[model samples]
Target: MSIICKYTIFYLSKPLNITTSSEAMLNQVRSVHNVRPPRMKYPLWYLQRERAKDDQQLTEDNRAFVKEAVHDKFGMPAVIHGISTYDVRSALREKSVEYENVEWSPKFQRTGLIARKLGNYPMWLNNGKSVLTTLLHVIDNHVIKYIPPGEFDPPRKPYSCPNHKKNLGCLLVGAESADPQYFTKQYCGLFYKEGMMPKKHLGRFLISPEAALQPGTPLMASHFNPGDFIDVRGKTIDRGFQGVMKRHGFHGMPATHGVTKSHRRGGNVGHGGEKGRIFPGTKMPGHMGNRYRIHKGAEILRINHKFNIIWIKGVASPGETNSIVYLYDTLLPLRKYKSSPPFPTSKVVEDDQLIDSYSEKMYKFTNQTITYEEEK
Candidate 1:
C-alpha cells in the first residue's frame, strides 16, 4: 500500500503543485490563487519502490489511494511512490535559519519551535501591489558538506542551546572563501569530499530527512521561488551610546541667550524634592546599534530559481553593504500577514538540459513601479 504526506514549513492553505518547463510532464507548478515561498531543493520526497512499479500503475484510481493512505499519514505528495528513500538530513543542513533578535523579542528559543513548528506564515503583497522589486545577490554558493541526521557527530548543543549539532542540522554551505585555519581538519575534509572550495559562510538547514540532497551540491538563487515569505536576519548598524537628547529624542534645554549651557543637556534628571531618584528605563541612552535584527514576514518579489537568489520586500534588511545575512521562510500565521500574496506555492518546468539555469530578466528594483498610474 502506497502513502502520501505534505509537511509544509508554512501553512499553505491552497492546493499545491510543482511543474517546470524542464520536465516533459508536470515537474513544476504555479497558480493564480496564491504566491508561495521560494522553491529550495528540499529532500522532502523520497520514494524507493519495493518492487519497481511502472508509471501506468500510478493511475488516477491509484492517486486517490496514495493520497488517502500515504499522503494522509506521511504528508508526502501522491506521485512519490516509486522513489528511493532519500535522506532529509542534508536539506536541514542547507538551511541557514534566520532567528529573531534577542533584544527585539525574548522568545528567541521559542522561535525555533515557532517556525515550521507552530505553523507556516502566509505570503503577502506590500501596499496592495501584486508584484514587488527588490535586491538579490546571485553568488556562486556551494554545498560543501552534507551531514545526514541521526548520523550527526559532535559540537552538539549544551542543552542550554536549542538546535545544536556537530554539523548542527544538515548541509553547511555559503558564499565564496572559508578560512581553513578557523575550521578543524575533519570539518575541512567534509568540504573536500564534496569537491567544493572552502565557503566563506556555512549554515545547516533543518529539512525533512526524507528529501535531503547529497554533498558537493552547487546551490544558487534557483533554490527559492518568487513570492514566498522569508524572514531576514542580519546585524544592524552599530551606534555608540548617547544622551537622552539623541537616543530617546528628549527635547533638551533650549539654546537661548540666558540658557546657553543647558542647551541639548537633559534637564533635571532626578526628582530631588519628592522621589530623589532616577527611575528605571529613563530613556537615558548609553549605547546603541550593533544588534542582531530580523525583518519579519518580508515578501519575496521574485525568485531566480536558476540562481538560488530571491528579492524580498522592504529595504530594512539589517547591516550595511556586504554584511552577511540569514534568510528563511517566515514563521508567522496567514491572518497576521499582509494580504494579496499567492495562497499556495508555485512551480514551472524549464529547459530539460538546464535544471540550474539563471534567469536573464530577473526582477530588479528598477522594475518595481509605484501606484502612480495615469488614468487614460
Candidate 2:
C-alpha cells in the first residue's frame, strides 16, 4: 500500500505533455503572487561607462604634429584675467549697471569653484592654539556654459530640492586647461564655442538665474574671501573590499578562549524564527570609501592670490592628497555669510597688489611679537 501511494504522488509531480484547463488555472494563480524586478532609475546612455582614455595608435611624429597644430589653433593657454578693477568700481558708482541691478540676496545662490587638495599643514592662532589646515590650489578655472532654469534638465531620480517651483539654473565650470589632442572630439567641442582649451576637470554648479556668468569668465581663489565658511565636496579615498574590523570598526572576537576562524566574521546575521532574513544596511564588510562626501562649514583661514591657493581650516576634508575637490558656499544657516560675497564672481585688476588675506584670529609671522602687560 505504501509503494502504491508513493508511485501515485510521483506521477502527479511530473509535468504532462498535454495542456489541461486545471494546469492553466494553477499557473495563473501563481503569476498573481510573483513580484516584478525593480526598474532602472536612469536611461541606458546615462551610464557613460566608456573608458575616458582613448588609444589613437599614432606615431611619435604624428603626436608631435597634432600638438603643434593644436597650439597654433588656440595660441598658448590664455592667462585667466578678471574684469578690470576700474569697470567694477564704475558699475558700483553708477548704481545703474547690471552688476548693481542684481544684488545678492539671502535666497540667491552663486557658482562654485574647482580646486585640488595639496596636502595639509598646521597654523597657529592668536590664543596660542594650533589648527590643522588643508591647502587647496584653485587652478585656471573658466565658465564654460550656462543653462537657463527652463532649459536645464537634470536626472529625476535623485531630486535634491523638495520644492518643485524653484527654478535653479545650471552653470558649467571647467578647470586645469589641457591639450586638446588628448581629449575626444565631443569633449573638445564643449570648449570650442567659448574659444577655450579643453579642461581636465569639469563641474556643474546650480545657481540662481540672476547669478549667471558669461562664458570664458575666469574664476580664481579670490572668489572666496578669508574667514568665510564654505563647503568642500570630494571623493573619498577608495579602500577596496575590506573586512568588518577595519571597514565598519567592528569589535572582533577575543583572541583567546579557543576562538576559531570566525574572529572577524559578522556572526548571526539573521534571526532563526519568524524574522528569517537579514536586515538591509546591516553594516557588513564590503567595498568601502570612494564615495562623494561633503565636508561642510570649513572656514577659510587664509587666501593666497599670487598662487591661487586657499587654506581651509581642518585636515579632515575628504579625499587623499592631490585629489580634486569642489568648493562652494556653506548651506549652514549660522555660518552663512551675512553680507554678499562676489556675486556672479569677483573681478580684479591686472595690477592688483593684494597678495595674502588672513583671518583676524590667525597669527601672522610678519606681525610684531606679542607682549603681555601687568594689570594696573
In model 1, the worst 10-residue window by lDDT is 109-118
- Tell me the TM-score of model 2: 0.77
Model 2 off-target regions past 4 Å? 1-68, 77-101, 157-166, 369-376
lDDT for 77 in candidate 1 is 28
> Which pairs of residues collide in model 2?
none
lDDT of 2 at 211: 87
Q: Which candidate number would show the highest lDDT if scored against the true structure? A: 2
- Report, for every candidate in turn, its global Cα lDDT versus the true structure: 0.46, 0.77
lDDT of model 1 at residue 249?
83
lDDT of 2: 0.77
